[model samples]
Target: MFAPIRWLILALQFATILPTPSVRTATERDIRCSVVWFPVIGMLLGVLLWVFQSFFVHHMPSLAASVVSLSIYTLATGALHLDGLMDTADAMGSRRPREAALEIMKDSRVGAMGVVVCLFAILGKWSAIASISPDHWEPFVVVPMMSRLGMIWSMVVAPSARSQGLGALFARKIPRWTVAVATCLCGAVCGLVLPFQQCLWVLLYAILTVTLFTGWMVHRFGGTTGDTYGALNEIMEWVGWYVFLCASA
Candidate 1:
């Protein structure tokens, strides 16, 4: 029996630092099926972030609170996505041929471009969080949730750049219908927290951002990899925050 709960647990364990009950056995199918639960994990993360931001904003200065909250956010995910972003940046920055660039990405050392982009991403998130009005809790929840949904979209639609690695397995194994299921679930949650029109717009932007980014990656690397998926998540999160900010304004 392929229990949905078990898949959800797999997703949580794969995507976050949060502890979960161990699943004694897991198959490639189980890992692939877990993609459906990614948005749910993002929603949970958003809830935690919203709650943390609400608490910290009252006790500390907005800038300081933003730093602390961002730190917690990064720590919670074990900086998994950020690591991907850096590796992707390093690969792209090399501007080498496709194979060489991928080699660069696989390298363990962080390059200069990687460090710079990482700093920018963190600073951008911090500034955006600090700027968001404490009364507006929607961005916190919507951004993270939508970003994870973006990952599913990328994995489902984009071919893997290589024959091996987690990205290839997910790309090869994920069911197409999972896209609709994940999108609807994410949409329903967004609708609950955001105005209908705004939710629709945010979803629209998410689709555009993910599609365009995936296309760009394909153009560069012949397809996407695990690093690209992480890179997309980080990029989409920033885009989501900005979209929400503009929508609220």
Candidate 2:
């Protein structure tokens, strides 16, 4: 229990831009152990976004408030997942051999596809937020948590694309029990934090969306990578928001 507590802190450190003491000697195994807390970090992010929206929505136009909320979300995650989404887009758009696609993803320079997808992701999110009433902000809290759960699901269902790196570490290490616990945590948290039907709606769609994404990724790359995990999070986030908007309506 104590060890997992430490791992949870480590997970928070890796997953967010929140201030955390540097873990200079943390091992790969430690990083793998942190998988259990991935959704926990997402939950925290959701809470923060909800609080931000709550504080600002009453003061500004919904679109403006939505943009501000999205900006805060970007900063909090250090744009890490967005970067992955772009890179994955570039790779997928290249439609080259797996090795070549991987190489494109490794490139630091953003390509046209990367730029377009990044724009789509941010703009789509902005529009989704704008579409909903500010009073219905519970979806903001639920979506991030569901998206992070998508990441964990991808890790469990797919093998690593590369021989080494964070993807490999997570692929080789996430325990089945950890995935189970994370799933249960997600359900419990959603049930408590959101309307019951909306909660189920989010979870069901999140899982199915991720399942389709995982299948496509596996077919394309023969496995998953860190970038795809991030991509999954981004895609699932949009899905969650859209689902919430529809369900709440």
Candidate 3:
């Protein structure tokens, strides 16, 4: 298999529940390079979602169709980012010292705060999907693509909170140039499907929101973690939907 193709496959394996050929000899460099493919995988997921929603909305209530689409979306990604959101919420909601909060984030147990935040995240996306005009399908693709792009940005700009874990590994090994490449890919996708002005607004919203959110995470956790990266992705998805909805409006 070609190296770039393998890297892309590794990325799909890591970020999604979608089945792919296993890379038994995947190197650390491969792992790092795979970050470049995150947005692509997101776009793929978005396409899946957009198609599913378009089909189901015709056969069922819009709300029910949205719920089913959202469920498929969650399952497709294995709810990996949602779990991150929950863990990060529990940690931040603990109001503990930075180190202790990090500890809370590491625990497998979900807390009350985690549940509340996760619920809100789901509801936010659901409402946005249900409320969106049936003619507006760009949000389905752009939102996922932009959110994953936001993850790449967060990983690049923020220091890792710990010396270990997936976040630190990515932060340490992912090439800085990967950010430019990923952003360009994301921009091209958005521009193809969205109005020029709306594309620009969506991109700006993603950059600004991710930047501000990263800063807050740094202040609270001293740096980004794997959990926080996931948290950012979820946050971007929720907010990205609304931004697109407004842009289209």
Cα-based RMSD of candidate 1: 1.2
Q: Give each model's clash number.
A: 0, 0, 0
lDDT per model vs. reference: 0.88, 0.85, 0.88
Arranged by lDDT with the best first, the candidates are: 3, 1, 2
Whole-model alpha-carbon lDDT for candidate 2: 0.85
How would you encode candidate 2's per-residue C-alpha lDDT over 12-104 as one tens digit per residue? 787787887666577777777788898888878877777777677789987888788879978999999999999999999999999999889
Q: What count of clashes does model 2 give?
A: 0
Off by over 4 Å in 3: none
Residues 100-155 of candidate 3: C-alpha lDDT, one tens digit per residue? 99999999999999999999999999988888866777787788989999999888
Q: After best superposition, candidate 2 residue 102: deviation in angstroms?
A: 0.6
Clashing residue pairs in candidate 2 (N, C-alpha, C atoms within 3 angstroms): none
Best-to-worst order by TM-score is 3, 1, 2
Error of 2 at 154 (Å): 0.8
Give the poorly placed runs of model 2, Cα more than 4 Å off: none
